[model samples]
Target: MFTGIVEEIGTVEAVEPGTDANGVVTDARLRVRGPLVTSDARPGDSIAVSGVCLTVTDLPGDGTFTADVMPETLRRTALGELGTGGRVNLERALAVGGRYGGHVVQGHVDGVGTVLSRTPGPRWDEVEIGLDPALARYVAEKGSITVSGVSLTVTRVGDDSFGVSLIPTTLAVTTLGSLAPGARVNLEVDVLAKYTERLLATAGSAGTAR
Candidate 1:
């Protein structure tokens, strides 16, 4: 599991085809090349690459690592479209004693969202994203949402969209600063909300049957 806290901004070095014959799955070699993240990384360790939980397949020296992207993961997340030199948010798995700086995140992208607008103010910027209809119910005002592996609070929510405010520190340290309107981003809604909704739905059905 992850905490949706971005540690570094990594770059894609290479992308090769995986064992899948349909050209759907891919193997990505990323170059974060940072000591704090790569020093103890081993095969099968989970790392959040731009909000997607990818297992390390190989750890090449010089700060580089490799992970395989499955076909379903490619279709459900935004990692499949990455090209060489593309920048991505990176975070290692949260340790047992690590501070919970952000909300709980699975590093699993539920779906992809598109940037709808960016309103810049004197001290902060408000980013709005159009989310998928199926995931819309999980978003709420003041709720937590992970976008591109960065945990952010939902400033506002609409029928099919949500907004997040970004401070200067967030802009400087993560890949969100470079996002423009219409750009695609990986989105993971709060897991608690999803579970709550399921329980409520089941209870409502049970009540109606009585």
Candidate 2:
């Protein structure tokens, strides 16, 4: 589990495509350079790379670690588009008794969203991100959403999009500041909303059976 707080901006060192016996690419291995995150890292540690939870497969002792990305993960998130020299938001797994800076984040990219527009303010930037209509029900105004591994509050919510305010600190620290219109980002809606929906559905089904 994670808290959706980005600890560092890591660089992709290499991406090795994994192929099958038939030479069909099925997965990818990514080596990312994050000095802070890799300092105490060991093989099998879970790290959130751009909102995607990946297990550390190897540590090369060079401030870099490797993880494998499955084909389904590539199809569902924007990590597949990442290449060498790409910047990615990185976060180590939440430690026991750690400060909960952000909301509960499973590091599971629910879906991919596109940056619709950016409205700059004197103090911050209000960014509108296009969302899938099916996922709209899970999002609410003033609720929390994780975008590219950074947790942010939804300032406004629409049927097909939502807005978030990025402060100067966020703009300076994470990769979100460089996002352009039409840029793809991994989005994870509030997990609490999903859990509530599931519980309500289960209760309704039980009432129906009675």
Candidate 3:
């Protein structure tokens, strides 16, 4: 599990697409340079690469680590659009008894969202992002949401979009500060909300059957 706390901004070193004998793309391998995350990273450690939990496959000992991205991950996330030299938010898995800075984050991207607008304030920027209809129910005003590995609170929510306020620290530290309108980002809603929904649905079904 992850805490949606971005440790550092890593650059994509390389992207190698895997193709089968029939020339069909099967998967992609990524080499990312994150000095802090790789400081103690082992071959089997889990790392969150821009909100996607990827297993560390190799450590080239040059502050770079490799992870294989399956086809399903590419189809569900913005990672497929990443190219060499692209900057991505990176975080190591939460250690036991560590300070819980952000909310519960699974490092699992639920869907991709687009930047719709950005309203700049003197101290912070209010950014609105388009949300998928299926995931809309999980978002609530003041609720927590993870956008490209940065945990942020929902300031305002609409039927098709949600807004978040990014402070100066967030703007200077993570990839969200550089996002422009129409840019795509990986999104993960609060997992507690999902579990609550599931429990409520099961209860309703039981009542109906009784």
lDDT of 1 by residue, 49-138 (tens): 999998888887678888877777888888877888888888999999999999999987889999999999898899999998789889
> Model 3 — TM-score against the truth?
0.98
For model 3, how does the per-residue alpha-carbon lDDT over 124-185 read when each residue is reduced to its tens digit?
99999998988989999999999999999999989889999999999999999899999999
- When 1 and 3 are scored with lDDT, the better candidate is 3
* C-alpha lDDT values of all predictions: 0.87, 0.95, 0.96
**Superposed Cα RMSD, model 2:** 0.9
Q: Which ten residues in a row have the lowest lDDT in candidate 3?
A: 18-27
Ranking by lDDT: 3, 2, 1
Please provide the root mean square deviation of candidate 3 (C-alpha atoms, Å): 0.8
Candidate 2 stretches with Cα past 4 Å from truth are none
Q: Against the hidden reference, what TM-scores do the models get?
A: 0.92, 0.98, 0.98
- lDDT string for model 2 (1-210, tens) is 899889999999999999999998789999999999999999999999999999999999999999999999998999999999999999999999999999999988899999999989998899999989999889999899999999999999999999999999999999998999999999999999999999999999999999
